[model samples]
Target: MTDDTLAEGKAADREKWKEKGVALRAFFYIFGTHVFAGFVWLLFYLGGHAQK
Candidate 1:
């Protein structure tokens, strides 16, 4: 109703849309998981036993 309350609500809405979990948390989570998975697959692909 008041300007002060409106400002606070706007600030909280902005913070809620920050998406810190998706951007920061997921950056490390997906990045680490994919990177490790890729490394493991690379080893298998380039292993001593080839599919010639």
Candidate 2:
């Protein structure tokens, strides 16, 4: 294949991997935040009840 064609192919593959990485990072970030927040809220809710 020509140099330009090969370069384009490599670029396309790079973009595909980058998109996948971004999506995976976003998923972990959001999931972790929600999980942590849920635990924190649960702690507060339980603590308030314990004081009563």
Candidate 3:
């Protein structure tokens, strides 16, 4: 293959991987926030009834 073609292929692959990484990071961030919110709610519920 020509150098230009090879460079284009590499650039495309890099962009693909970068996109995948960004998506994965966003998924993890959303997942973590949901989990943390659940945990906080659980703690609040558990302690809330005890105060009554």
Candidate 4:
């Protein structure tokens, strides 16, 4: 294949990977937020029960 063709293919692959990365990052961000919120809620629940 010509150098130009090879370069284009590489660029396309890079773009595909970038899109996947963005999606994975978004998923992790959302998942992490929920986990953190749950942890905080648990702490509050325990504290409230302990006071009684």
TM-score of 1: 0.52
Clashing pairs in 4: none
Question: What is each predicted model's overall lDDT from 0 to 1?
Answer: 0.88, 0.98, 0.98, 0.98
lDDT of 4: 0.98
Cα TM-score per model: 0.52, 0.90, 0.91, 0.76
Better of 2 and 3 by TM-score: 3
- RMSD of each predicted structure: 3.7, 1.1, 1.1, 1.5
lDDT of 1: 0.88
Ranking by TM-score: 3, 2, 4, 1
Q: lDDT by residue for model 3 over 1-52, one digit each (tens)? A: 9999999999999999999999999999999999999999999999988855
lDDT of 3 at 17: 100
Residue 29, model 4: Cα distance from true site in angstroms: 1.5
Query: What local lDDT score does residue 39 receive in model 3, on the 0 to 100 scale?
Result: 100
* Model 1 collision count: 0
Q: Pairs clashing in candidate 3?
A: none
Worst 10 residues of 4 by lDDT: 43-52
Give the runs in model 2 whose Cα sits over 4 Å from its true position: none
Better of 1 and 4 by TM-score: 4
lDDT (Cα) of model 3 = 0.98
Give the alpha carbon lDDT tens digit for every residue of 3-47 in model 1.
999999999988877876558987899899999999999999888
